[model samples]
Target: MSVTGLPSASGLPDLRQVTPVDEVGVNERVARFQTRSIKKESKIEALKMILSMIDLTTLEGQDTPGKVRQLCQKAIHLHDSMPGLPHVAAVCVYPTMVGVARKALGDCDINVASVATAFPSGMSSRKIKLEETRTAVAEGADEIDMVISRGAFLQGDYGFVFDEIAAVKEACGDAHLKVILETGELGTLDLVRRASVLAMHAGADFIKTSTGKIQPAATMPVTFVMLKAIKSFYFETGRMIGMKPAGGISGAKLAVHYLVMLRETLGNAWMTPEWFRFGASSLANDVLMQLQKQATGVYQSADYFSKD
Candidate 1:
């Protein structure tokens, strides 16, 4: 509500007034982004750019102190063999592991991003969610990725979802807040766009596509819908917002396609890591391989790239 695109009085945006998304048009436009041709040098540059914008994430229930530490290490020194490679933008982990990630990253420019608000499921009470976010921030997380209450949003309880996001944003304090919409569960592009509006109005610093738990996560159509909503909001209020397509983005070519979509939809301003990110766990390795191939003129085995 303190952000642009919402009424100053109540802080809750009316879902009824949201523009209806055209699923077909969205698909067509998404296809065009895929078709946009790039020269070899441009693609090499894009691969490096994608690497810099990666939020190297690990949210598995099996995540441990050691696993998070290894991931943190990877974030800092991706591939020493390749000269002048930029580190990843951030590392994402569960809230409990924020301290582990922070300590391992220790003074590195790479940010420590944590998933809070009961994460992948967002099924817990608001009290617990807010406390979890606060705990993550206190533990030195630079960014908090929170999930919206998908069950409530699916039940048409937009008020509950909106208020929950707003409260989580407040709990974040100085940390950036990324509101995950879990578009896979939203069931349609129209609803995805609506949720995008809700999250942005509720003060999300970034609107992520999914938590990477659900199947069909971060599909092109779903991301297109979310991008459209962001465009509409920016046009209406003249304020810039960030986007992160978190799940199922692993291949280098697909990542470049996403950059094309972001550039065409939100313009050059949103192209930076500050505004755009790929919330993927295995994506960094693939990007590194792509860069290696560009340098060596041969395909690479995954063994050369470090695993998350």
Candidate 2:
């Protein structure tokens, strides 16, 4: 399919090949070594560390205006009320609701993220996709989460995928573009790696996995492949791209495992919110409970966790 009204074959790059990684040998070694000690942290300390990297974006389909506003308020409250209040990196919502989050967040320094480009499916016309991205950015979305056309990518139409991302990047202007590969549907480690490189070359600030709409989203094995791809891309272009594994990640322990993987695969530079993020809604409570457990030496019931 043609992306952004441009012919699929024109202004696109070949996607069958992989980038070389000979120069990153040293960085990879250092990352692997640093991550080796991930198992040493106590459960509570580990949870706190990972919770600090969360984005806490909400994207439920049943979200109403009232609920969206409530989520925004809760996010703001968390930013203020929580002790030592490590604010979530962003508050993600639908494109139409960007204004709600923007109005509620108001100079809070938290990014307002929106999912566009036929999100969750990516099966729309390129014109609509571009307009969607442009509209989201115009609506004050600081970060744009877009899904790749799996049909086109799997059909050997890598060029189509690449141009789509590039066109969306152009629409984003100053907004950060996060390209979601929908790794569950991509179905192979090699495709994940190729898609990662394609997104980076097309100007993606981050390469994400899943729309949180698919089953088996964000597995560690797939994440491992994508992290390696990020490492390889950095070696080639010297541009550090972010990684986000969304969907079904609901507990502090799982988040820490992802953090450990990131620390091991990309080193300390990748540990911060700029380089890594977990897209989750229920994860915060689990992390909080773990934190409470650490403080009191007893596990807290689910009731003790905040429902916001």
Candidate 3:
């Protein structure tokens, strides 16, 4: 109920006081971000930063140990010819594949992230969601990507949604939790802003945009609204929060625009992979291709990069 959108004494944000989003203002700001130009040197550096911030994901029904290991290898040795390219932020997979990815990543700094809580749908019971989270963390998952129950949230059961996130965060123990808002299904920018505030107040280390499973995923305007929400939350609580915009962001140019938006909105403190990430499946390869172009002055064939 505080003016800054911080949690009330009862530990839940007052949804009534959550700021309403300005869609027109957000759209105009996003358009300006796209128009800002970066010099070639800055562009190359931005590409490298993008590569490091990506969470190379493979959340598929057909995911197998072999396939997961191959993806891990790609994460470790992303374009060996480049020599100094940084590995991705993490490898995201189903909870069953978390151990496989962990063992494959070896001692490298790359994290093993698992999508739990009946991922993509989030239609299971709270007990099941908590147990799944514990299992993934026990199996060596460093990060847990949990989807919020949009149906409950949309039905005005904000307290239920808040409690679920807090319970899941406790189950995660040492693992960081990334709460996916799935903005596409939320229906409006105001709801997206409200959900972002709720997630952060309920113990989410990061507030994510989508599951990469639906249309209108991770649009510039949606991300802009979330970033602004994060700014307000930090001003109130003096605690930093991370942001991740998943799905539909494949090209290096669009990714750069996002970075520009982040820097301009949140300043330099949040410019690292630890504070921001991209939950993507193919974004790594596209960034590699772009980096290669920057290095060689000509685009390399898409086949040059692995599609794992």
- How do the predictions measure up, each by TM-score? 0.96, 0.87, 0.97
Give the worst 10-residue stretch by lDDT in candidate 2. 4-13
- Tens digits of per-residue lDDT, candidate 3, 219-265, equal 99999999999999999999999999999998888999999999999
lDDT of 1 by residue, 105-213 (tens): 9897999999999888998988999999999999999999999988888877777788888889889999999999998888988789889998998899999999899
Please give the distance, in angstroms, between residue 127's alpha carbon in candidate 3 and its true position after superposition. 0.6
Off by over 4 Å in 2: 1-14, 19-45, 79-82
* Model 1 quality (TM-score): 0.96
TM-score of candidate 2 on Cα atoms, chains taken together: 0.87
Q: Is candidate 1 or candidate 3 better by lDDT?
A: 3
Candidate 3 structure lDDT:
0.92
Find the candidate with the highest TM-score and give its number: 3
Question: Between candidates 2 and 3, which one is better according to lDDT?
Answer: 3
Q: Cα RMSD to native, each candidate?
A: 2.8, 4.6, 2.5
Which candidate ranks first by lDDT, i.e. highest? 3
What's the best-to-worst order under lDDT?
Answer: 3, 1, 2
